[model samples]
Target: MNTTSLPKPNSMEFDIHAKLKAANSHWSYCYAVHPHDKGFDYQFNTTFVGEMEFAVYERIENYFVLVDFFKSYDEACDDAKKIIDDHPDIKKMFSVS
Candidate 1:
């Protein structure tokens, strides 16, 4: 009798292109209140070519005080919050539920 060992399956690799496509396909907007700035910011995830992209915009009065683009929404939000929190004059802003 001969016994054969089953080959182990390789861990799934993250497909950057596929993920970017999916993220763009399901593109939706979300935002988090800045812990120190009473300003509104917009965030969205998109795909460019075959790479993931993220964007954030903060409007102050009638001008955009902050405009940022990132590789992921999570990173964009994190950076935006840090900026808002660092300003002592700004207060965290939130939307009404």
Candidate 2:
């Protein structure tokens, strides 16, 4: 819960808001991860926001980025929790679509 000593992440390579827009633009939703630079791609797809579907591609020195795709809002939140359990420092970086 304490972030005072956490290392700052680099700028995102991919745009979170952009992905959210594309996800909300239609039924297809997306979830992915990217570092401040172009280097890799996802951590994958899951069931959709209502119906059914996803990336995790981020690496900044000693850090690893992870992303999860879901079928509902609950799924997204759940994934966020799990991620936080393992990566509490990146909690603020999470974006919802």
Candidate 3:
């Protein structure tokens, strides 16, 4: 038998990390949260390579902003859905499936 210790993730941290991992499967990207923003800001890149990369950001309070360089809106949507599916708790947050 093998046992591995995975660090326990807080609710918000788990949601964000899970979402980002799901997004990465479809879009070659990286996601991170800004500590100073109190989880209000998230950053993601839509490309595997650096030079042609694009970032997408969402501000928890105000709006969801699309930063365009490449990639389709549909892809982003699908990625978002995958994230929700990967973590059911997120659906519970809005009381929907």
| lDDT, candidate 3, 1-97, per-residue tens | 1122223334533343454444442332333434565745544444544223334555545444433222332323434544444556543543424
Report the lDDT tens digits of candidate 1 across residue range 4-85: 2212224654333343344443332324455454554443234565554444445555443334444432333444546645
Ranking by TM-score: 1, 3, 2
Question: CA lDDT of each candidate?
Answer: 0.40, 0.38, 0.39
lDDT tens readout by residue for model 2, 1-97: 1112212124644444454444553323332334453454323323345434423323434444444333333344344446444654444444464
Better of 1 and 3 by lDDT: 1
Worst 10 residues of 2 by lDDT: 1-10
Question: TM-score, each model?
Answer: 0.30, 0.22, 0.23
> Best by lDDT, which number?
1
User: In lDDT terms, how accurate is model 2?
Assistant: 0.38
What's the C-alpha lDDT at position 90 in model 3? 44
Q: Tell me the spans in candidate 2 whose CA falls farther than 4 Å from its real position.
A: 1-14, 21-42, 66-97
After TM-score superposition, what is the CA distance of residue 64 in candidate 3 from its true location, in Å? 11
Model 3: residues with Cα > 4 Å off, grouped in runs: 1-32, 36-76, 94-97
